[model samples]
Target: MNSIPFDIVGFDLDGTLIDTSGDLAAAVNHAIGTIGRDPFPAADIHPFVGKGARVMLQRALDASGGYDDAMLSALLPILLDHYAQNLAIYSTPYPGAVQALDALAARGVRIALCTNKAERFTIPLMQQIGLHDRFASIVSGDTVGVSKPDPAPIRAMIERAGGGRAIFVGDTINDIAGARNAGIANIAVGFGFLDGPVEQLQADAVIAHFDELVPLLERWPG
Candidate 1:
C-alpha cells in the first residue's frame, strides 16, 4: 500500500491538468501540411503530449515515418509558432479537474504544476483556463536547467511548496520517472495523454478518474 496525506501536490500540465491535444494536433498537422506531408489526427499523437514543443515535434515527425532530421529541424519552429497562435483556443482542463484541485486545496494541500512545457506557453494556458492562481508555484521547462524524468524540476516544486510531503500526479511515463527521481510517490491517471495503460508507467497508484484523487490523497499517510 502506498502512503498519502501529502501536504503538496505536483501536477503535470499538458496531459494531466489540461487536455491541449486538440490544439496541439492542429499545430502539428499545420506543420505537416506546410511541408507537404500527410497530417495525422489528434488521437494518433497522444503519446507525444507531455514533453515540450521540440520533443513533440520530433515525435510527430517520427510518427509521420518519412521525415529526416533536417526535415524535422526545418518544420519545428513553424509548428511551434502555429501552436502558440492557437494555444488554448479549444484547450481546457480535464473533467473534474478544478473540483479536484479545490478539494485538495481545502484539505491544505499545496498545488504546483511541473511541466516540460516552456513558461511562455504554460503560464498563458493556466491563465486562459482561470487556473493561474490555483498553483502555489509553476515550474516550467525554461525554469530549470533540466526537465522531467530528471527530477530537478520536481525538486524545485517541492522546495517551492515548502518541502513537506507531496505527491505528483500525471499521465505519462516521464511524470512517473520524475516523481520517483524526486523521491515522491506518484499517482498516474488514465484519463489523459498516455499511449497505454498507466500501469505500464509503474506508478505507485493509478487513478481512472479525477474524482478518485480526493479519496486517494485524503487517505494517504503523512
Candidate 2:
C-alpha cells in the first residue's frame, strides 16, 4: 500500500528540482558580453531565476546597467541559444533529489514537472540530466499556453499526470502561490533561488534538503 497521501506529486523544474543558477548566469553573461556588459558572478544570478528567460535576462541587464526595449529584444535570443546549448554544464540536481524521486516512485506516487522554463530548454535539460523518463508528465512555461501563478499549467500537469490528490513542491512564488491557486497542498524548498526568506513564499511546509522530503510527505495530513 502507498504510504504517501497524494497520488501525484508535481514540482517546479528550475529551482525546485535542479540548481540552474550557474549555467543560467553563464548564459546571461554571454548575452550581456555581446553588449560589452561585464559578467555577473553565478551566485549573483540566483534571485533572477524562477520567472522565465525574459525576466532573467531583464534582471541581468537591469543589474549591469539598464535596458531599453531594444536591448532586451535584441539579447533575448542570444541568451536562450547559449542556455540551450550549455544547459547541463553547470546544472545538477539538488542533493538527495534523485533519491527522493526514487522513494516517491517506490511508494507508487506519480511524479510530474511543471516549470516556467520553455519546452525548448526544459525538455533538453531533463534529457541531459537523465531525468526525463522519471516524470510521468512534463509541462513547460509554454506547454499549456500559460505559466505559473495563473494555475492553468499546473492544473494541466495534474490532469496529464493521471490526476488524483496532488501536492506541489516549488521554490518560488510562482510555484507555491500557483499551487494555492490550484487549491492543492504545497511545500517550499529552502535552497532554491529564493528572492526573500523561505517562509515568505507561504508554502504549507518548507524543507532545506531533499532528504527531508519523503518523511515530510509521509506526514502530510491532507
Candidate 3:
C-alpha cells in the first residue's frame, strides 16, 4: 500500500473528535444555575466551547448575569466536577470518526489529541468514551502549561506522537491558528463548534463529515 501523506494526524478533543457539547452545556448550566441564572440551551453553548471550562463558564455567566474572579473561582470547580461525573453521558464520537481513525492507523499514521480541555477532565472524558488507548499522544491544556492558539500544545502533541510530518484537525480558530503557528496544515470540521461560517476559518481544507477525512488526507499536498 502507498504511504499516507501525513505520518501523524493530530486532533482537537471536544468538538473535533468527540461531541461533548451536551455534557459541557449541562455543566455550564449547573454553574450558572447556582447563581440563580437561567440555563442556556446546549445549542447556544456551542459557541462558548473550544477554549476551556473556565472560559466556557465565564462566557455563560457574562451573558446571563456578569461575573467576577471570586464568582468564577467558586463556579469553575463546580462546573468541572459536574462535567467529570457526567463526562460521557451525552458525549460520543462524530459519525464515522472511529472508522476514520482506524483507516489512518491502517496507513501507519499516528493519531494524537491536542485539546484545551484540562488534563484532569480530558483523561476521564476520553476514558469514558473508550478512546483513551487509541491516541499515540494526548496533550491537554495544562499538560504543557499553555493552551491552543499558542502552538505550544500542538508542538507538544507532535513531539509526543514521536515526531513526524503532521496535520491537525479541529473546529475552531484556536485550532486553525495553532496549527498555522506550529507550521502544519489544518483541516477544519464543518460539523464542529464553529463560531462562524466554515469558509471564514480559511483552513487548508474543510470537511463536513469524518468519512471524508481519509480521502482528503490522501490527496493533501505535501
Candidate 4:
C-alpha cells in the first residue's frame, strides 16, 4: 500500500457516497413512459450513469430504441420532474456511509462534497441522507463555471475548505480525471457504478467498502 496521504477528503455524491441508481432508474423509466416509449430496465440505464444528466438522458433515450432531438427534448423535462418527485424515495447512502463520515469528522478531517450532480438535486439529496452537516464545502456541478474532469470543482472545494492535503473518493472516469486535473490523489470504490476494474481507472487507491476509509485516513499524512 502507498499509504493514504491527505487531510481533507472529497467525495463524489452519486455513486460513491449514495446509491442513486434506483431513483435514477425510476426517473428514466418515467420519462420513457411519458414519451410513449417502452420503459428500459434499471440494468440498462445503470451504465449511463456517472456522466451527467444530459448524457444520461441521451443514453437512456437511445438505449430504449432511438430518440431524435425532438423526442429527447420532450422527454428530458419528464425525467427531471420524475427525479425531483421521487428524489429520496429509493436513494440512500451505501453501507457504512454514515459511520465513515462520522469517523472522519471525529478525526478532524475536513470533508467536502465535490459532485458533478446539479445543485438543485445535490443539496436536497445530501440533506435527506443527513450528510449536509458533515461537509465543510459542497461543490456541485453548477457551483462553478466548469464541472468535473475540468478540475475547477475539485479545486473550488479544496480552496473553499481552507486548502490543505486532500483526497478524493469517487467511482467513475470523470472522478479520476477531475482528481488528476486538480493534482490530487483519488480513491475508487468497487461497489459503485463504474463498469470495470478499479485499477483501470488509474486512481491512487481503491477500496471495497466505506469503513476501509477509516484506516486509510488514519495513516494518511493529514
Candidate 5:
C-alpha cells in the first residue's frame, strides 16, 4: 500500500464528524424548559455548539430570557443528564464519515478525536454511536487542563495518538485556531455548524463532504 501523508488525523466531535444538533438542541431545551423557557429549534442551536455544553446552554438561555450563575449551575447537570440519556437518539455520523474513516485507515492512518466536549459526554456519545473503538485516541476538553484554541489539548491528542505528523479537521474557530496554534494543518468542513461562512474560518482547505477528505489530505502540500 502507498504511504499516506499524515500519520495521525484528528477530528472535532460535534458538527465535524457527526451531526449532533438534534440531541444537543433537545438537551438545551430540556434544561431551559425547567425554567419555563420555550425550546429552540435544532437549527438555531447549531451555532451555539462547538464551544461546549455549558456555553451552548448559556447562549440558549441568554437568547430566551436571561441567565445568571445560579441558573447555569443548577441547569448544567440537568442538561447533561438529559443529553446523556438521549445521546444517540438524534445523533449520527455525517454523510460519508464512516467511509472516510475506513479510507484513512486503509492508508495506515491513525484516527484520533480531539473534541471540546468533555470526556463524560464525549466517550458515552461515541460509544452510543458505535464509533468509540474507531479512534486510536480520544482527547476531550477535560483531558487536558485546557481545551481547543489553547493548543495544549491538540498537542495532547497528538501525543496520545502515539505521536507523528498530524492534521486536524474541524468546523469552528476554536478547532481551526487550535490546530494552527498547535502548528498543524487543518481542514474545515463546510457542512459543520458555523457562525459564518466556512471560508471565513480560513482553514488550509475546506471540504463540503467527507467523501472529499481523503483525497484532499493525500494531495495536501503539507
Candidate 6:
C-alpha cells in the first residue's frame, strides 16, 4: 500500500525542481547586451528569479544599469525570444530531483508542478527536460489568469492532480505563500534560488536536499 501521507505533491519549477539560472542569465544578458551592458554571472541571477521573466529582466536591467519604460518595452521581447529558443540549453534537474520524483511516483503520489513561468516557456522547457510527462498537472502563471502568491494556480494544480491531501514544495515566498493561501502544507528547499535565506519563506518544513524529501513526507501525519 502507498505509505506517503499526501495523495498529491506539488512543486515549483525553476529553483525547486531545476537549476535554470544559466539559461535565465543568458536570456537576461542577451537583452541587456543590446544596450551594451555587461553580462551578469549565472549565480548572481538566482535571487532575481521566483517571479516571471518580465520581473526577472527588470531586476537584471536595474542591476546592470537602469531602464526606462520605453527601454524596458523594447528589451522585453528580446529577452523572451532568446529564452524561448534556448530554454533548456543549460537547464538541468536539481541534484536528486529525479530520484525524489521517482520515489514519490513509486509510492503512488500524484506529482504536479506550478510555476510563475508562463506557458510559453514552462511547457517547452519541461518537455525538453523530459519532465513534462511526469507531472499529472502543470499550472503556469497564465494558466488561470493569476500566478503564485495568489493561490489560484496552486489550487488549480491540486484539483487537476486528482485532489486529496496535498503538500507543496518550492523555493520562494510565492510558493510558500501560495500553498498557504490554498490551505496546504509546504516544504521549502534549502538549495533553491532563494532571494533570501530559505527559512524566511517560512515553509511548514525545510529540506536541504531531495534525498531528504521522501523521509520528510513519510513522517508527515497528513
> Which regions of candidate 6 are displaced past 4 Å?
none
Error of 5 at 173 (Å): 1.1
User: Which residue segments of model 4 deviate by more than 4 Å?
Assistant: 1-5
Q: lDDT (0-100) at residue 117 of candidate 1?
A: 89
TM-score of 6: 0.97
Put down candidate 6 lDDT per residue, 111-199, tens digits, no spaces.
99999888999999999999999999999999999988999999999999888999999998999999999999999999988788888
**Model 1: ten consecutive residues of lowest lDDT:** 1-10
* lDDT by residue for model 1 (137-156), tens: 89988798889899999999
Each candidate structure's TM-score, on Cα atoms with residue i matched to residue i, is 0.92, 0.97, 0.93, 0.93, 0.94, 0.97
lDDT, candidate 2, 138-221, per-residue tens: 999999899999899999999999989999999999999899999999999999988899999988999999999999999988
- Candidate-wise lDDT, in order: 0.85, 0.93, 0.91, 0.86, 0.92, 0.92
What TM-score does prediction 3 earn?
0.93
Per-residue lDDT tens digits for candidate 3, residues 1-222, read 646788899999888999999999999999888888999889899889866787888889889979899999999999988887899989999999999999998898999999988888899988888999999999998999989899999999999999989999999999999999999999999998887899998999999999999999888876
lDDT of 5 at 116: 86
Cα lDDT tens digits for candidate 4, 1-222 = 224356689999998999999899889888888767787677778898767767788988777787889987887888887797777888889999889988777767788999988898999888886779889999998899789989999999999998998889999988988999999988899889887877889888888999898897666554
By summed lDDT, the worst window of 10 consecutive residues in model 4 runs over 1-10
Evaluate residue 33 in candidate 4 and report its C-alpha lDDT on the 0 to 100 scale. Answer: 84
> Can you list the residue pairs that collide in candidate 6?
none
What are the per-residue Cα lDDT tens digits for candidate 5 across 109-162? 999999988788899999989999999999999898898899999999999999
Give the runs in model 2 whose Cα sits over 4 Å from its true position. none
Q: After aligning candidate 5 to the native by TM-score, how far in Å is the CA of 25 from where it should be?
A: 0.7
Give stretches of model 1 more than 4 Å off: 1-4, 62-65
